[model samples]
Structures are given as structure tokens and as C-alpha cells.
Target: MKIAVVGAGLGGLSFGACAARDGHEVILIDKNDEPGGVMALAREGGFSFEQGPLILTDLREDEAVGGFLASLGIHLETVRDDRGLSTPDFDLIPPEEYEGPDWRKRRLEELFPAEKKGIREYYRFYDALMEIRFLSGEKKGLLNQLRLLRAFLTVKPYENMTCRRFTEKLFSDEKLRLVFNGILADFCADADEVQCFTLPFVNTETAFDKRIPTEKKGKLYYPSYRYIVGGCQKLPEALCAYILEHNGRFLSRTVAEKVLVEAGRAVGVRLEDGREIRADMVVGCGSARDFFTELVGEEYLDGNYRRILRDFRPMEAVFMLHLGVDFDPSAFQKQSLCYYYGSYDLHGAVEKLRSGVYHRGSDGYLIYFPDRHAPAFAPPGCHCVTIYTVCPDRLREGDWESRKELFADELIRLAEEHLPGLSEHIVAKKIVTAEDYRRLTHMKKSSFGGAVPIWKQRNPPYLTPVKDLIFVGAQSESGGGVPIVLLGAVEAYEKAIRANRAEGKGPAAGPV
Candidate 1:
């Protein structure tokens, strides 16, 4: 069981390919010579682009990541979300076709037609508070947790509310409360501080296909949003080629640098050239307070988790730009993922992006167009596009290495008001500031998306008190994606193959 797994990211190549397909003897460390931490990649002239998480949704109805990449035989190519809807008072709002849930309640009654009875009483109070909080805390089994203890006291009135005061108390519509606060703006918190049971997974296909089940194990499906025709660096090189076809061990530019504790457990890793392997556990995949206060030395933590990794608070980060353009944003019908408001004052531009400063007259932008759903990420007629906008990871109005190209030229002058000669269709460019995501994802405030202190304050948040390290990043939980961090690295390799069958240690792989 020689695990290791430091940070090849996409939750350390999905927990080093499910703990080396569970015979365990994996490796996968990374400071990045290659690996999808932030599911990254960014070439230049011949195109490529997607420097992180660009809507690759094929989890195929929770089999999770196309049935975990067809159980690692691996199959990449996917593409959906056919464009339209460019906004700032429309450019093309005539797109609707992925019909499910009465075509998403007739596209939210055709985009808030005076809140059609407050959009059917807001999806019947968000499907009865997600069926009493998943029939009392996520459908229990194994003797139904004592018959679901009265559906966990009817989930205490939808976990005491806040999806910005329950969607602004069910509607008065400021463009549907800034389109539901831009679907929780990469969730760096706010929507009255998240937690209305995390706003019914904020439109994951209208929160599990417009629920109508109190039984049948709290049914939920959600899968339509695809694009992985090339970038997403072929998903961590297909989980590092299924952990090197199961023999595992693929270090790459090493640099783990610590975590080799002894009597107090987690026995491996210590590689900034000094090299040491050891291991029965030590997994991390990066930034759970940067390897517990810089690679395992918070003196084995436990002053209430070293004051929760020293008063954690990082949630705001994006500022990408990418571009490789000539033109082809689905030829202007646009929308290979679009959300541009320009100003509705999304919570006062998230309180002026915590003073890292980017007031594009009140910040907003999340355009993508990976050549509009993958024309192999651009070449013939060009287009990579990308673009992003959340902020504040620092740059107190100056040094993001000399003003990240003037904040990518003021977000390309607000993405040239919906690409009208978008700075004469450049041939190539790249930006990614917020101190280049805290120097390419060590993520202090480079946040990107995940960790708003487990919003509603820790439903499940433990980022290393050192039980053999552990934390699969995006600051470990709160719905970071790439199929929720590859379903949290296959549930931490099914709790490390159930603690190696309780130390007898062998034959246990259940959970393909």
C-alpha cells in the first residue's frame, strides 16, 4: 500500500487512479511538469487554451466522469451546449434545446416573464427543500440510519435558509437577482452566504431534474454540459494513463518536500531532491493549507486543526483571459458558456472584489467559447476565447507582476462589449492573474472555486489534522468540479480500501 499522491491534481490524478486500482502501490507527486491541477493547459499560436475547468460535464448521470472514464479504458471527445444568449441586453437569446424538466420550466418562464408566479413558487420551494434534505441527510442506508430519524427532523426548515435570503425571498427580480448571483459566482461565498442546502446545486439541470421523489432513494441525475475534445489536458492525461496502467508511480518534476512523519503516522514523501518514498497513506493533491502549513509541519496539527489551517479565508480568484481568437464564437450566435452582466452590482461586485481592485464599472464576465464547444479548440477560423472575472487574491492596486497586463487590458475592455471587433481578433494571448492563481495554484487566495469554509460552515471539511494527510483539493470540498474532484478521488480510494481491510491488508477493491 505505498500511496504518496501529493498533487498531480484533479485530485491527484484521481487519488492516483483510485489508489492504483486498489492493489495500492501508487505514487503521483507533482509540482507540475504535467498533470491537471486546475485541469490546466494553455498553448499559444496553434491554439489549445483552457487554463482550467472549462465545463466538461460528462459524468454520465453520476457514474461520475463518464462512468469514471468507462472504468479507465478512457474515452475523451465530448461536446454540447450549442451557443446563443450573449447578454448586456441580448445578442442571441434564442437557443433552448436541451429539454428536460419542462424545458427548465419553459426556460424560467422565458427568462423571468415578470416572475411567472415567482417562477412556480420557485420550483415549489426548490423542490420542497430538496426532499427534506435528501430524505434526511443524503439517503441513509445500512438499516436506514434507524429509519432516518424522522427524516432528520425534517431538515430543520431547509437548513435555516440563505441562497441570498432564499432567492431574495422568492423574487422581486433584479434580473432574477443577478441571475441568482451568477449561479453563486464561482462560489467564493455570498448569496447571502450560500447554504440554502447549497442552493439546490445551483441549476445542475434544475437541481436534479425538477424533483418529484420522496422515495426511490432521493433521485437526482444532472449531466448535460460537455467539452473535452482536447483541452482539460485530456483530463490529467487520462488519470495519468490510469495510473500507468495500474503499476502506478509517476513522480514528474518531483518536489513534495516533506510530510514524512513517523510515529504519528503518514510515513512517506520528502522529495525536493533528497528523495524518500515510504508510505501506506499520505495523499493530498495540494493546498489543504498548502500541505498542512507548508508540507506537514504544523507540529502535527490539532489546536482545533491549527485554528482551521490558521483561520482560512480564501474563496475569491479568477481573472483569466486566454484568447487565441480570430473570430468564431460559434460564429456570433455565441454561448459556448456565457454569462455577462457588466453590472447589476452582484453583491456590489462582491464587495469591490475585496480591494484587489477590478471595477469594470462593477465587474462581471464568464465567457468561454472553447471554439464554441470544441472545434478542436481552434485553428480554421480561430477561437479559444476563455475570459473570466472573479477577483481579489491580492494586488492592492499594483503588483500582480506589474499589473497583469493592466488586468488583461481591463478584461479586454469588458470583452470589447461582446466581441465587437474584440481588439481586432488577436492571434494569441494569455493572462490568468490573481498573481497567476497564487503562482499557478498553490492557492492561498488563488481560490478559483471551492472552500467558502464549507459554506454554512463545514458540513464535511477537514483539511488535514494529519490522519495520513488526505485532503483532495479546491481547498478540499464544497463542490469543486471535474466531477467533484473526481468524486473526491474516488472517495479517497474508498477510505483507502477500508483501511486496507483493517490492516490484514489485502484483496479489497470494491467500487469500480
Candidate 2:
């Protein structure tokens, strides 16, 4: 079968790589000069920085993502990493001495003695959920099913509570509540909008401190977080190389103008240059709104798919400032990355973001030391840093390009609170706004991540109404995150193959 995948992001690349490996002709199209989409490296002066995921989970050799890459002959060196959480009055940074997995629980209990009872209760629920997650990942078996059933019964009482109610029910102190619900603002979602079960996954202790063991009693108790030794761009680069080695083609700097449909089946794609490449299957990724309305024409979509496209909310863009400094930021920030939240009002912050208000990094921002994992990202005696926050893709007051510098300066000033004398460092700086991501992702709205992950929210599905046209990526039913997208792409390809076989269609010749 010949496959034409639009948007050379991880999703498309993964799908194309799998198809090419199976002896199918693959064609990947993207507007960027290179693959990787958001995973592309941003270079300024002599410094390089990652514009996408900071730390990824489930890429270890035994994990789903790693095993998939290994099948494609792609092996990337990875290093363990963690993030720190801080507020104006307190911080949840890892201690210099290695603490156990229950460290965060103990610390929270200490800070809010009045709510110690509630904190302990929450951890019990957290541990139960973790057990369920661990078991669900295990191979199918009667024992696993029995264990999962028992685990699910333990926390069944609080399953329906929203994040807002869960936090308020657990902690009376506003500061304590933010500890769990603060991360929701990053998703551009209100605490009341997400489920209580989401609390543990987002606040995984292993993600906050690399020292926390991922295994207990010879079983994987918690998920491990890792960074590709060189950079995230390595993942896409390897996939592209694998695709090319298998006789696949990439049309970089090309725009897919439309998905050609014939007899209710997608037959090919037409490039903006008026060149049409016929394919047995067409895969669409990136910006569901753009893919359906601009490329696939809404008339071909079913009512449910169209309703999802209209109702589903994609996350807003991020404001990233990459810097190359003469001094070491690691000195002040012990960890390579730290999430400094400015406010405890997560509900208010998310509302402001969706309403086209730019917080200028005041609500929350993270400081990441890129040179820690990838030493090549900086010059000798120098280090690279990225300070960023999730903000509105389209601002209400003025455009992103016009306010880019002001927002950059504001973020720097806010970061100075964590790294003293940060402004005095002579450095190279690159400001990335929503407008830049808009052009990069080829979306007018420029949602940095996929969807907001709202509870019961409808997202674009992989199997579309149009036969032979499959969708893969963050916006798809798989949702966002590196591991999800990679595995989702493979699953989507399998689904497409199954659908083709069911329709009695055999593999076809390569596209001309």
C-alpha cells in the first residue's frame, strides 16, 4: 500500500515509518524544512534548546515507546530527569538527600499540619490508583484482571469528584490545594473541569524527583521520566532516517492543500503547487480543525465527527524564551527543571488564558536547563536555559508579535525571583510566541499541545467517516504526550490496515 501522511510531526513520522517498514511506499509532507514539527530544535547564537516536551515518560527499554522504536532500529540514549514545584511562599523541590517515593506526601503533611489527616487519605487513594495503572500496563491475564479489580474497588468512592471538589475536600488551606491542582492550568483547563483521578497522574512523585525509585518489590510501581540524551529532536530524526532507508520520501517545505476523495474514499493529496500524489491511504495529523475544514472538506465528515471538531477544545500556545548565558543557572536551581507557580488560583488563571489574556509568566512558568542532558546545546563555559509558560494563542489586547518583547522581559523578571541576578548575565535570547507556533504547526489557533483533556470531551477519532483516511496525532483520540502519540500512530496504522483488509482491498503500487 502507498501512504501519504500530512504533517511530518511525530505522529505522521511514526505512522510513515511503520508503513515503510512493512514494504509500503510512504510520503511525508510538512511546511517546515525539517521533520519533528514542535520537536525541532531552536538554535540561537551558539545555543540549542528544545521547543517541545521537557521530560517524557515510558521511553525506557522495557516500555511501549522504547520497544516500538527498537523495532524500527532506532535506539536513543536517554537520561533520567525530574521537575521541581514552587509557589511564592513554598516549594516542593527534591531534597539534597535522596528521599523515598512518599517524600512529597510527608512534606505536604508537615506544611499543613491541620490537613495532615486529609493528606494521608489522599495518598492512600493515590497509591491505589498507581497500582491500578501499573496493573493495566501488564500483559493480559486472569491474575492481572483480579488484581486490577481489587485495586479499582479501593478508590471507587472518589472516582466521580472533579479536581476542584477533590482538592477543596482534602485541604482547607488554599496554598495546599494549589499543590495538586496547579498543574491543571498548564493544560488550560479549570480544576472543576477535570476528574479527581487525574490528580495522581499529573502529580506523579517520580516526575518531581528522579531519585524516587520506579520499582518496588520487583515490580514497576511508578513510571520513570527520561530525556533523550542529545535532545527530543533525536526521536523524529531517527524515524525520518528509518523511513528514508526504506525508500520513503519526504516533501519538506510543502503544503498539502487538499485530501482528494473519490467514491467516498480518500485517494490522494494535492499539494499547494498543484501537484497531486495518489496513495492507497492518506494519514492526516496536526490541528484537527485545519485538517478537516481546510484539507478534508467538512462535507465528507459525519455529523458526530463534525460535532467533535466544533466542540473539542485544543490547548493554547506557549511563550518560550531560550537563553544562552555565561553563568550557570543550575547553581540556583538544583534540578535541571523547576515549575514556579505565581498564583494559587488555578481556576482563575485558566479562565484568563482561554479568554485571550497573556499572564506574561505570572501565573506559572518553568525554568529548564537544556545543557544538562545535551551538553552540546551550549558553548564551553556557557549554559543554555529555557523559560516558558502556557498562554493564549490569540491575545485580546494586541497581537503576539507586537507584545513578544514585553512578554519576554516580563517572564525574565519573574524567573529572576528563582535565579537571582538573572538579568545581569550577558546572553543570546530567542523569543517564541504563539505566532511562531501558528506558522510552525500550520494552525491559525496554534494549540501547543493537542486537546485540553477535558473529561468526556469528544476528540477527532483515528477511523474517520472517509474510508482509507486515518488521523493520528495529539488531537486524535489518543490525546497528547510523546508516548501516547508514538504508540497511537502504530495503533492507527494497524487499524487502517484492518479496515483495508475488511474492505477487500489489497496493497497497491507506489504513488507516482
Candidate 3:
């Protein structure tokens, strides 16, 4: 079977690699000059910076992402890593001494003496969820099922609570509540909009400190964060190389204008240059609304899919400044990446973001040192820093291109509160706004991440109503994150291959 995949992001690359490896003719189409979309590195004046987050999860050899890559004979060096969190009045920095895994709980109790009882109770709930997570990852069997059920029963009382209600129930101090819910601002979601069960996973203690043990009693307890030695681009590069080696083709710098369908089945893709490539299967990713309405035509969509496209909410964009400095920022900021939150009102911040109000990094912003991991990203005597915060794709007052520089200056000024003399040492800089992301991701309103983790929200599914046309990516049902997209794409490909076999369609020119 010949397959044409649109948008050579991680989703398309992973799917193409799988189909090509299975002896199918695979062709990947992307508008970018390179394969990886946001994973692609940005270079300015000898300084390199990744457009996405540096720390990832589940890429170890025994993990889901790593196991899949090993199957394709592709492996890259990975380093264990973690991030730091801070607020205006407090910081969650790991101590130099190796504290126990439950150190955060003890520290929180110390900081908020009045809420010590609530803190202890919250950790109990967190432990129950962690046990459920571990059991769910076990091999499927009657024993595992019963074990998972027993674990789930511990926290069953809070199953229906929203993040806001649960946090209010736990901590009386608003600052203490922000410790768990502040991360949701990155998704442009309100605490009331998300499920309480996601709080522990999103605020995983292991992610805040690398010293925390991920293995307990010879079994994986909590997931450890990791980073690709070179950068995240390595993952996409490896997948693309595998596809090419397997006799597949990548049409870079080419736009896939439309998905051609006849008699309710996708037949091929129409390129922007007025060329059409026929294929047995068509896979797509990007803005679900844009792709369905403009490329595939909404008339062909079923009522259920159309309803999801209308109701599902994708996240807003981000404002970032990548700089090359003459000093080592690590001298002041210990962690390579630190989230500096200026405000504790996460709900107000998220509302402002949705209403076209830019916080200018006052709510929260992160400063990352890419050079610490990828030393070659800067000159021998220099280092690199990326200061960024989430913002709306469109502003109510003015456009991004017109106000991006001013906003960048304001964000840098805010970051200066943490890194003294930050502006004086900058030798080079690159500012990225929502406008740049919109053009790069090919969406009118760029969603920096995928859909917000709203409870009971229905994202677009991989298997569409139209036969032979599938969807995969951050925006797909798999949701956002590096491990999720990589694993989800492979699963989608397997389903597609199975469907083809059921339809009596095998490889185009080889034995299946």
C-alpha cells in the first residue's frame, strides 16, 4: 500500500517510518525545509535553541518510547534531567543533600505550618494515584486488573472532583494551592476545567528533583524525565532516516493543499504546485479545524466528528526570546530550567490568556539554558538562555508583529528579577511570537500545544468516518507530549495496516 502523510511532524514521521519498515511505499509531505516541526532547532549567530521543552519522559530503554525506537534500530543518547519551580515568595529547589523522595511533602509542611494537616492528606491522595499509575502499566491480566482496581479504590472518593474544588478542599492557603495547579496555566486551562486526578501526574515530584529515586524495591515507581543529548531534533531525524533507508520519500518544502476523496474514500493528496500524488492511505495532522474545513471539506465529515471539531479547545501560543550571553546563568539559577511564577492566581491568568490579554510574563515564565546540555549551541566563552511564557495567539489591543519586541523587553525585565543584569550581558537574541508559530505550524490561530486537558473533552480520533484517512499528532486523540505522540502514531499505523489487510490491500510492490 502506498501512503501519503501530511505535515512531517513527529506524528507523520513516526507513521511513515512504521509503514515504510513494513514494506509499504511511504511518502511524507511537509512545508518546512526539514522534517521535525517544532522539534526543529533554531539557530541565530552561532547559538542553537530548541523551540520546545527540553525535558521529556518515557524515552528510556525499558519505557514505551524507547522500546518502540529500539524496534526500528534507532537509539540516541539520553540524559536524566529535572526542572525547578519557584514562586514570588518561595522556591522549590532541590537540596544539595539527597533528601528522601517525600522531601517535598515535609518542606511544604514547614512553609505552610497552618496547612500541615492538608499537606499530609494531599500526599496520601497523591500516593494512592501513584499506585494506580504503576499498576495500570503492568501487563494486562486478571491479576493486574484486580490489582489496579484495588489501587483505584483508595482515591475513588475524589474521582468526580475538578482540580479547583479538590485544591480548595485540601489547602486553605491560596499559595499552597497554586503549587499543584500552577502548571495548568501552561496549557491555557483553568483549574475548574481540568480533572483532579491529573494534578499528581502533572506535578510529579520526580520531575522537580533528579535526586528522587524513580525505582523502588526493584520496580519502576515514578517516571523519570530525560533529554536527548544533542536535542529533541534527534528523535525526528532518526525516524526520518529510517523511513528513507526503507525506500520511502519525504517531500520537504512542499505543501499538501488538499486531501482528495471520491465515493467517501480518500484517493490521494493534491499539492500546492498543482500536482497530485495517488496513495492507498492518507494521514494528516495540524489544526483539526483548518485541515478538515479547508483541506478535506467539512461536508464529508460525520456529525459526531464535526461536533468534536467545534467543541474541542486547542491551547493558545507562547512568546519566547532566545539569547546568547557572555556569562553563565547557571551561576545564579542552579537548574538548567526553572519556572518562575510571579502570580498565584492561575485562574485569572488563564482567563486573560483566553481573552486576548498578554500577561507579559508577570503571571509566570521559564528561563532555560540550552547550552548546559548542548555545549556546542554557544561559543566557548558564551552561554544560551531561553525566556518564555504562554500567551494568546491573537491580542485584543494590537498584533504580535507590532508588539512582540515590546513584550519581549517586558518579559526580559521580569526575568531580571531572578537573573540580575540579564539585559546587560545579551550579545545576541531571537524573539519568537505567535505570528511566527502560526506561519510555521500552518494554522490561522496557532495552538502552541494541543487541546487543553478539559474533563470529558472529546478530541479528534485517529480513525475518521472517512475510510483510509487517519489523524495523528499533538492535536489528535493521543493528546500532547513527546512520548504520547511517538507511541500514538505507531499505534495508529498498526491500526491502518490492519485495516488494509482486512480490505485485501497489501504492500504496493513487495510481500507483506
Candidate 4:
């Protein structure tokens, strides 16, 4: 079976490599000069930028990602033992910010000492939930769900209630509520809009049970987190190597013009170079909208089906700024680990963004100094940083292209405020704007990958209206981040096998 996968992002690489390993002919095509697509490595002078995916949370002991990497002879070490803290020694930074698994509970103890017992029980419940899900192989039977129904309803509460409403019930202080709010902000939705299940998503990220460690005044504090030994690019490069070693082929620097579909079935893909590559399955690691409306053509889809994919909203876009500095970046690592501008009005800031505004004063950003843990990122005595946050996908002041440099400059200024002299230390830099994201990652309007994690789009199914056409990547609405994207890739691979079985085709006789 010849499988043609479009886009060489993490999702595509995972599926293609898995299929090729199973003795299927896999041909991955991407417009980029190398593999890995968006997850691909970017370097300048002697500095390397992680590009996409700031953290690779391990999930569980049986995490498919670790297994997949092991199969490719890639061993990842636990990197960055770190915690979040208020940075830059500023007067505005809340003097008592916290990080790590213990921070949440410890924070409540400090601000609302009376709620200490309730806080302990709250985290205990969530810890058990993670255990149960892990035991169920991340899937629960009907009986299991029914048995857990009461527990689910406990945290879940009313379906539409946001994190603000839910957490306020537990803590009255707005700062404490905001402290907890940081845990779920990845959803890109307002605190009030974020759903309940996010607790497990945030806590169960580790492969092993993390025994909370004591935090000292100045050290990184988390017990579990995996950073690439050398750089994040190692992941995609390893996947590509595995696929190639299994005899899989790749068409690099080629744009996929369309997916060749006939009689309501996908046959192959037509490249922009006028070359058509035939395949038994077409798994697109790009936007779902692109496959139906652009690649396969909207005429191939029914009007109603087309409308649903069209109406599905893209996740909010984020601004990513990577800076390579001439000075030792680790000097600011303590501040960057999870530094946040304090006393923020998260809900109000998010609201302003929806109205096409930049609430610079109200909104806070994340700064991660990779070199502190992974020195391979920059040459000796130098460092690299990833500064990002959710920003409006569509801007108000000017087009993103025209305004990108200014936005980056402002971000640098902000970084300077947080890590005094961050501006002077800079030697090289790359700014990823909404427009750059749309072009590089093929995201819809440069939206971040993954659904908002509400009922509708959270963990959306793989099967599509078009038979044998499975969608992977952010637009499918499965939760975002590295682990979730890889999980979707697993679904895609399994579905491809089943699709072939249904057609009376078994696994390929040998590797392609």
C-alpha cells in the first residue's frame, strides 16, 4: 500500500513513519526544504531555535511517543527541572508567584489558608482522575464512564461555566483565581470560557508519578519535563530517518496542488509540479478545510458537509519570538522558566484581543530560556529564548506583515523589562507572526493547532464525510500541544490500516 501524506509536521511524520515501519510504502511531501515541517529546526550563525513546541510533556508510562522514539533508537532525557516565577524583580510582579505541581496547592495555603484542606482534596481528585485515565489506556468503557459520572460532574459542573466561575467557588481572591487560571490558559479561551477537563490535561503530562519537590528561592522547580538532548529538531529528523531506513520516500520542496479523488474516494495527490503520486491512502497533516475545499476541491464534498468544515472555527493564533543572544541565556533562565507579568486582568485582556486590540498592559506573555537546560541550543556563552502568547489572529492597527517587526520590538522591550538587558544581549532573532504561521504551518489564518478544548471540538473524531480521507493536525480540533498532535497521528495510522482492511487489503507485503 502506497500512502501519500501531505505536510511533514509532527503529525505527518509520526503517521508516515509508523506506516512505513509496518511495511507500507510511504511518501511524505512538503513544501519545505527538509522534513519536520513546522517542527523542523531553524538555525542562525551558531544558535538553534526550537521553533514549535516549547515543552514535550511525557503523558504516561505507555506513552506512544516514547515507544515510537525508542523504536527509532531515540532516547530522550528528562530536561529542565524548572518552575514558574514572577520575573525581572519588578514592583508590579506579584511578590508571591509559584510554579510546579506543588505551587497550586502551596499557593492556596499562603493566600487562603482556611481553604488548605479543600485545596488538597481538589488536587487529590484530579490526581486520581489522571490515574484512572492512564489505567484505561486513555480511553474509558461505558461502564467506567458511568461509574466516574458523579466524579466528572463534580469538577465539570455546568457545561458552559468557565474556569473563572468554577475556580472562584474554591478561592475568593482574584489573584489566587488568576494563579489557577494560568494552568488552563493554553486553551486560548477566556478563563470563564475554558472547560473543566483541562485539569487532567495540565497535570497528567508526566510519564511517571511526580513526587513534588521543595522549591528553593532561585532554582528551577518542576519534577517532570522532557527537553530534547540537543534540540527539538532531533524529533522530526529521527522520524524522517526511521521512515527512510524503512525505505519510505519523500518529495521535498514540492507543494501539493490537489488530492486526486474519484467516485467519492481519494486516489492520490497532484503536486504543483504537475506530478501525480498515487497512493492507497491520503492522510493530510494540514488543515481540514484545505483538504476539502482546496486539495480535493469543494465540489467533491456535499454543500452541508462543506459548510460544517467551513464553519468550524480555527484556534486563536499566537505570536512566537525566538532570540539568540551573545550572552549566557541561563543568566535569565530563572526568570524565563515560566515568567509572567503579574496582577493581570486575563479575562479583560482576552476580550480586548477578540475585538482586534492588543491589551499590552493587561495581557501577559511566556518566556522560556531553553539554553538554561539545553545548552546545545546556542554556542558556548550564548543563549536562545522562546517568548510567546496568544495574540489576535487578525490585527487592527495594520496588516501583520507591516506590523510584525514593531510587535517584535515591543515584545523585546517587554522582555527587557522582565529580564533587564535582554535587548542589549540579542545577537540574532526570528519573529513568527500570524502571517508567517499561516504560510509555514498551513494553519487556517495562522491559528494555533488544537481545538479550544470545549465539548464540540475537543478530541474530535478522525473519520470524515469523505471516505478514506482522515484529517490530522490542529484544525481537527483535538487538543493541541505535542502529545495531542501525536495522538491524532496514531488515530490516523490505525484508521488507515482499518480502511485498507475494509477494502480487503492487508498490511503491505514488504516496506516501500
Which residue runs of candidate 4 sit more than 4 Å off their true CA positions? 59-62, 78-80, 85-104, 114-121, 137-162, 203-223, 302-307, 458-460, 506-512
Candidate 3 lDDT, 127-195, residue by residue in tens:
889988888777899987887787688678889999999999989999999999999998888999999
Estimate the overall C-alpha local distance difference test score of candidate 2: 0.89
Where in model 2 is the C-alpha error above 4 Å? 139-146, 477-479, 507-512
Tens digits of per-residue lDDT, candidate 4, 477-510, equal 5457776687678767787677667777665553
| Every candidate's lDDT | 0.66, 0.89, 0.88, 0.67
Among these predictions, the greatest lDDT belongs to: 2
* Clash count, one per candidate: 3, 0, 2, 4
Worst 10 residues of 3 by lDDT: 503-512
Q: Which residue pairs overlap in candidate 3's backbone?
A: 1-507, 1-508
Output the better candidate (2/4) by TM-score.
2
lDDT tens per residue, model 2, 355-392: 99988787889999988999999999999889999999
What RMSD does model 3 have?
1.7
Instruction: Between candidates 2 and 4, name the one with more favorable lDDT.
Output: 2
Q: What is the lDDT of candidate 3?
A: 0.88
